[model samples]
Target: MGTVEETLKCPVCQDFFTDPVSLSCGHDFCLTCIQAVWETEGSDEVPFFCPECQIFLPSDVTLEINTNLQTKAHALLHQQRSALREHTVVEVTGDPLSLKCQEHRDELKLFCMEEMVPVCCLCVLVGMHKNHKVFQLHEACVDFKTSAADFKERISDKYSRIRVVLDGDERLMMQIIDAEEMYMTEWLEAQRGHMEAQIKEIDSLRASRKSLLQEEIELRFLQQIKAQNLWNPLDLTPIQEVDKDLCDLEKLTTVERLVDDLSVALSQHFPRMWSHLSSPALDSKSAHPKLEISQDRKQVYWRTQPVSEALSPQPYDSQYSVLAQESFTTGRHYWEVIVQEKPYWLVGVTTGPVDKRDALSQSSSSLGVHNTSWCIYHGYGQYLACHDTQEKQLSVGKRVRKLGILANLQKGELSFYNADTMTLLHSFCVQCTEPIYPMLNPCIDASGLNTQPLTMFWIKDHWDWHINTEGAKE
Candidate 1:
């Protein structure tokens, strides 16, 4: 049989263990010895292999003290000392870790963040670690932080794949909506044409009959009345009856419920969006002479008369429009606006510096009409998306009161939404060269009807705060 010393030696260290640890391969080694071996031969970026067994272990495998081996080692030392009572020495008052500075004899307490090691008071005050940084043991540890960071990255990778599936679903749903809108629009237009023809015939018959009555001669009036025989009562109803529900209340409610559920399921992504959810205020400096911004800077509206006060040095040549104060240069951002019951308005984003040459001239540098901007315009019973003077007529299922804008700079895309229903209205793809600012235009007041100011909608400090308000769940 081998000596007692040979049986207690670590496989890697080849010495008596100090904080022994056991691997799943049934091999034992000193904790520090195994750490040094793996750190030099392998790494946290790759699987760790047992030095003796060569068995692979996950990179995240934690190193911890083997209590059974430590107890056995302590017992063996106790028995060896008992056999030589003349030289007995023990210090039961030491710390549980049995660690103490060789010179100061103080417990190793603080951890030096820079050096990645434990330190004592004198080591931090006057020794080698005098100028090194440190933290209390209970406050933070490199091991715990590294482990947490690695695990968080894994979770984020998995969630990113899940988001891809959700995005595909969203795209499919939007296509279906567009298709249904197109078919319904065709039917509505045909019915409207038929109604117009019937009204024109009725108007012609009424005018001719009135002229016959004013014929002056009684004989001619009688003859004219005989020649013009009055037709049977006209059918005022539509020629083709509406078989399907135009407004399905049940389906709308179901949509709202589904959106609510989606909002909850996707709350994980909200922190990113919410972190930048600043309801950017209207920049009065960018407003037209006839446009007015609220005192609080959240609302903007077109005025009947121009501002009488002396205007600033900047040009006041906008089309009753203004840009937001905040500008975004990178990353994905979402913002919303309230256009509730307003008849005419425009909402969009603009990139690059404002041109002093045109200011807000509708024909020159107007939003959506200019190459540097994109916008959604509503006026005279039409919802249209405009970019670079090219207009794409949008088919919105319902009247949009709230508008949502999502600007994804990395992907080079901008998406507009029907905020109330979370339905996508349109999206634009553009490569940005610089910063982009949110733009708002409360179009000209028509006969004192569309005077309501456009209001900004956004999340403040809470989660699950905005699903009902607009296109986003805050």
Candidate 2:
């Protein structure tokens, strides 16, 4: 027969079960242990398989208590406790409890500091830890405890410092938000007031024009009544002159003139808003093999040679395009590109770290698709603003030579302007979370008609602005 201790012990925990329960397969285990096993197996709604027999139990199956097993476990535990109590009494009386090595059956006098284990004299001579540094067990224990306490204290100090830094950062962020809110509110209110005043002035002008028209109408009626009998054609000249003047006044009050005036006002107010002119250089590393970058890194164009084989491992498969070396994360920046009648080209900004392999496919990798980038595409005789796979056709009358980009990250605005004419082409309001890089695609034409290099204008200091031939060094 098996020993009482072995018979009462649960297989799951290898200890006497507090509440033994039997499964459908007649296997007994601690109630908590079986439940924990089922939970770990992820069988909350489904039946779980038995650990030993692999027998499936129903989800709603009730657990039955193994009373006989529980009784045996309790008796065995009581006997063990009684034996422990007797040993405790002996130890209390003056006899010290001695620790012995399991393998050698000798007193463990020395401890291996390197291995952190107690060993006997025989163990030190021939055991696996024979070459390990040895120390007195009591001394090693005290040293480890003191080191653990020191580490705990250091951890506490670091945690406190982190909390203090986080608190300071939070306060700083709140202050910044408060200042921005106040400034925006004031700016908006001023704009509203200006618009209201403009509306009143327009209404007054309309009233004056209406009065002049009514007076002319009444004068013509009187002239017709006097000329009804005389029938003289010379009197019609004065009415015709008055009508021409009225037409001139109507032209002066047109919507087109109003829009032109507004544009002029805005340009004056926000002149050089982006003081920092970022002279972006072409990044050769991200350029395609078919695209040739200038030595000065200011221009990029389509190569004459066919791109059958890559000179180096191409970073991206956007075979006609290249990105700028510089990227913008915050603040306002302005840059100009001189296309100079490049019929086919793409100029814009990209939230970079563009995947090289994925850019091979045009449909997915194009600048505007999926909010990866925004750009102005010039194809043949038309201009298009593209973003998120959508294109907006721009009505540009003349061919654009110089393209200006004004990016204000804080204001969440990106504007494109015809630099030569100083006319706004398109603007985008985007919430960008990543750094944006200027991108260029000097498209390859089969006819070789569109080979003009896309050149970037480099500005020096604010006082003396000059185009640097070798591009921006920084």
Candidate 3:
């Protein structure tokens, strides 16, 4: 009885009853807890009892009675007991039968997904773990520990890369702003100088016209006086007549020339002044100002793209090392093979004038767009100039759809791509130091509507070598 008081709790009503009842089976529990469960079944005398053990009661014994054991159990509950509560305090919170492990007395940390109970790892392995889902705390902790370190490293690296990109963007913006300010200042000064010069020229023209007008008026006045004196029958004073005519002529010429010069100056200056002042607004649409810095940090061609109109491509025949050049004779027709090793081709097309230029540059302008002509599709695996051909400005007929493979034995890498799309289609490692001779076959159809591409070959040192395509075995 003392052992039962220390360990077991009722499954139905949870509390340790004053009187403990023993069923027909060996199981025992509080009498009140079983009675309460019986009442819930709505029977005057329950056909079954010991709800905890589910044992049947005797049909002949139906009376409810009190026993001396009830008084003794009640006195034991109020007495000083063990640290692990000896008396059960009835609770309605959750499952009443659930209890800590009897072996270690430890709260279970593992969850049995099947039975929906917390258990220790040992209990799961012996009972709940067979053909059922179980979660162990130690396993979860180990998995999280491994993932946490990797995530932290990734986040740290990402932030560092973002900072570098932001710094570069800030530098570019500052350069653009500075270049625009300088360009505006220079333009404004030039406009002011031109306007001032025009104004000075207008003033000079007015002075010249004024002098000519005065001279004409003086001569006419003198001629009028001379004719009047000559026709007079009565004698007249020459000085008084000349003085009166001269005064009237001076007044008329002054008013007439002043009005004419003022009108001319206003008409000329109005349009010029307005144009000079409004030039800033018009200048906004002009090319974006740029700054070019030399190796020594000195200003070079400011507010200009690095590319120049006079720029020409250097010939590849001189710059690159030729791997093989073989010529064959087929009677009248000459068959030839020329293989050259170079950095992977930056293939493009252009449609502009191509009278005198390298074959590559001519192809690009006729086919490629600006900025899209410098893509490295294979070796470097960049997609820079991929979209240039799609632009409407680039002529459609001058399309470049030829790919060049670059196999660098020194670097142990092979890079190849689609020439038209500038997409990196292949990249792998090479083992052999010797150069690989890629096969060449001329396109059968060369109709202008769907022009055939030129076959390119790379022969390594005159040997009949073929690309070993055995999963990078070579």
Give the TM-score of each candidate.
0.38, 0.38, 0.22
Q: Write the per-residue lDDT of candidate 3 for residues 1-474, one digit (tens) a residue.
A: 547555344455555554566555655457676667777875875476555555677766433323444444555565546653654343232222234543445556666666655566567656545556767655655655778998999999998997887677557555655665577567667766766776676677567546555755777756754754634563422221223442244433554565567558755644321121100011111111222222321111122223344433321111111111221111111111121121222332112122222322333233223332222221112233233343222212322344544444456544444434544544444454222222221111111111122233222343211232233336
Worst 10 residues of 3 by lDDT: 276-285
lDDT of 1 by residue, 228-277 (tens): 65444534443455456763445445555776788788775655544445
- Model 1 clash count equals 2
Clashing pairs in 1: 318-360, 419-470
Query: Candidate 3: lDDT of 178?
Result: 67
State, as a TM-score between 0 and 1, how close model 1 is to the true structure. Answer: 0.38
Winner of 1 and 3 under TM-score: 1
Q: What is each predicted model's overall lDDT from 0 to 1?
A: 0.74, 0.72, 0.39
- lDDT per residue (tens digit) for residues 299-387 in model 2: 99778665454332332223467888898889788998998756677889887555634443444265434586888888777898988
Q: Any runs in candidate 2 off by more than 4 Å, and if so which?
A: 1-274, 307-319, 354-368, 460-474
Error of 1 at 190 (Å): 86
The TM-score that candidate 3 achieves is 0.22
What is the total number of backbone clashes in candidate 3?
12
